[model samples]
Target: MTIQLPTEIWWRILDYLPSNKVKQLGRVNRAFLEKARQSRYQSLVIYEYDKKTKRRLKKIRSSSLGHYVRSLTLCVQAWPASDLIRWDGQTGDSLSVVDRVRSLFDSHYLPRKTVALKKKRLDRRIELIFEAMTAFEHIQEYELIWEEYDQDCPEEFIPEVKFASSLMTIFLSMLVISPLRGTLTKLSLQIPTHIALDCLAAADFPFLEDLKVFLWKSQCSRAKDWDILTGYLGSENLAKFISGLSSTLQTLSISRLDPSINLDRDFGRVFDLLCRTNFPFLRSFDFCTRSRYLRKGTPSLDRFVRQISHSVRSLKLSHLAYDTSSSSPLHHLDHRSWISNVLSVQGLQTRAFSSLTSLRIKDGSLSAHLADLSALLTSVAHQLVSFFLEDNLLTLKEVETVVCSLSHSSSPLRYLGIEPRDLAPDTFDLLVCAFPGLRELSLSFERFTSSDDDVIPMTEEDVRCMFPNLCLDLGFFCFGLMNTAGATADGIICLRLRSAVSLEIELCLMR
Candidate 1:
């Protein structure tokens, strides 16, 4: 080990080099591999197969770059039963008596799991995935994607492995976590509540900081088979399942079409976990549910929001409420007000929205109304200076409340977006008049009436009179961009008014 090239300059040089060049440098020698490890083998996508994966594993294991992999994605998909026989020829001769015995034990002891294919294929795939994944020892993030829906399904199915095959991805998900426990910092996995809860309870990720779990199709699972995840798995079990990540997880996003139809208790359990667990460093919590506001659950959810309001910095919730009283698709807006009230809780006067800086609510059948919204802005305008609201702004009365309530508050809002139905010249004028200190505003006027009452337009001076410190966007205005020098509030505003009776103002807020 005599003199060599300076190691400190390698990073700077690698910055300008492409990926192929980095791989090229990694193969140069032991020194080059060690120095270029970070950029050489940064990401890897593994498909579940024997030969391809075996070859890759062999290459990475023999090379020094295998220790440098930081992110690994395992996309486990099902193969037809025909493919299962192809492995028989190879495995029949290769599998030892102990190996066969271990496979039997895996089926018996591995959480009663399933894959998307026959048990034989599922078992083989799981074994192959585990074997390949164990080679990458330095991975920090792991993602497991099941391709059940992406490929053709077996029309004739056996109940046993069909369910197990579906769960093979989850089983592999647990296995993926085991190898990376000491080094993993992020895990984005898709495991059913029943499986994940059990697997995670026993597993520990010392350095794991982020965990994203996608709650899969519970309705179909419940409808078709007596599956463990849906048939017997309840929210309490699900909560206990996720609690394993409480100490380490700082960011979480669990998205679904809406699992509450089958697992309402699971949704409740999430809030319960939040209430009981004190994750001091947890900065963001993102959750989505499709069920309407059933009784008991809303109150607990409200309480959860109240607790996390002062802690979590960013929150995004969707499809959160539904009409508990009526079964109609149309939601009576009043029911959603409670959620809004809890989220923007404060005193009577305008102030800063303390913990939350950005919030995007998408409930197709809801809005906070002009009055409650004004209160929310009055309370949070100082700190929550920016917000986007989609509402059917049809009444002047509501517009007046916004102006009267928050206009004089110390925490005047700096940014606001409102989509109103039945656009009126006077109401639009009054809305601008309300936010005297507004720096930026976006207004969309839909369902435009050609009648004289609705068609009243405002001149530039009229606009200026209404929005004192603001400039109108004036799409395709009289002059070019340079001519609009006097624009205020981020330079311009847009009045997107459309004429039509068919369009209804649908405010997609968290239901």
Candidate 2:
């Protein structure tokens, strides 16, 4: 007798089984094995530490698991000696402990773990990890996280290691050599600049639609190396890379470049390359930096904005504060103005983005520049559905002006986020009125003051008075007074109206 079931039912049952278990069931018979092989698994996670209890994973020949995988996360834990301090006066030698761990890792024959380095050995360890990653044939998304190790007096035996930086270079090298380019949809290189450039030059991910490159502060101090780094990312090379990318690449994010390094010429060249390139599918753009403005005017910023004006649908601008001194009022204002000018110009462009639906501005104020920003918002508000402004300096009145501009338009905007100071009563009402289709709203209120009668009851009259168009998804956080009756009730009604809408209410009670 044989068990006969519908194919759909079998697939549904198989979905309930773990990958390892599915593999086990596959070995039970040929039918099970074929079904298991056909299953489309979406995520693959490879960790540095081996599980204490090891179970045998099915070894299938000639079958690549890459096609089914959508996302990949790699976590590498470098030995931390300081974490192993004993309560007694006697302290464990950090290097000796690391050596013991390395020895145990060496015992394993796994490809990624095969290259276990001796204590204080950095280069060899990185090599081994790269060798192991070569087996992954198709990878759509990749994440690399390297833990830092402490350098205490007792741990002097451990070499002053830049392990993360070295590891990044090796990973980039693998991307160049790997045949996974065509299938690679998203590539995130969280490494230093040199390695990122090297990887960019090595392979062309024709299907690469999204790219995020993170450059950390490198201790390497040679003018020649810096020149080489920039040289690799020159206009010609960038053009070649984009051209080879099957014309599918869209979103690009570069982080943490040296602030002192003048980005005007380089960014201009990049903008030219992108403008010349045909990105029919490009829709979103994000530019973030920790560097300060070396020159007074932000030509690079303006040029970059102009280049992408026609295509960008979703945009995010973030500036990282390097130090307290670097956070001077003048410098901060300069950065804000540069960003504002770009937004204003882009908004005014005749060939505006028709597909833009979402916009986010972070860590800077858009108030002083709201008039310019309002022009941009008015241009795209018709198609815009979500807008987020976090940690920006804006007064209640300014926020209302922008919201009023957006509301007047016949746009589909349903979600709005603003900083704490911008959430005044009048401004809140204005936002609710403007985005009639609004399903989600987030407010960061700096101070919420109320007189003696804080918790006022809401009648039908009040509801109509507050919001004539009552349908919305409300998320509110008040930094001052917690007692606001109608606010909470209105929030509940908004949540109940739309199943898709999410509401969050936080009241900061006054002391």
Top model number, TM-score: 2
Tens-digit lDDT string for candidate 2 (1-511): 5575667876887888876777576675666666776673455555532221011011211255535556666654433445444222123223345555776767553333323432224454444445334555555777765444333323342332334445555665666666666567887755533334545654666678887765544333224556435543433454456546636868877664555333455555555565555666667778766654422335655765666666777888766655536356534544445567677777777856666788887645456567777877787777888888765645656776777667655768877776545234455456656765666666655444332244333333443345454444434333233455223222222223343564333322222
Residue 42, model 1: Cα distance from true site in angstroms: 2.5
Off by over 4 Å in 1: 1-40, 47-50, 78-120, 147-154, 157-173, 192-196, 218-234, 260-264, 292-296, 320-330, 334-338, 341-353, 368-374, 390-418, 422-511
Clashing pairs in 2: 206-245, 407-434, 420-444, 420-446, 439-473
Give the per-residue lDDT digits (tens) of candidate 1, residues 285-334.
77665555422234456556665556666666655444434564436555
The local lDDT score (0 to 100) that residue 128 gets in candidate 2 is 42
For model 1, the local distance difference test gives: 0.54
TM-score for each model: 0.62, 0.68
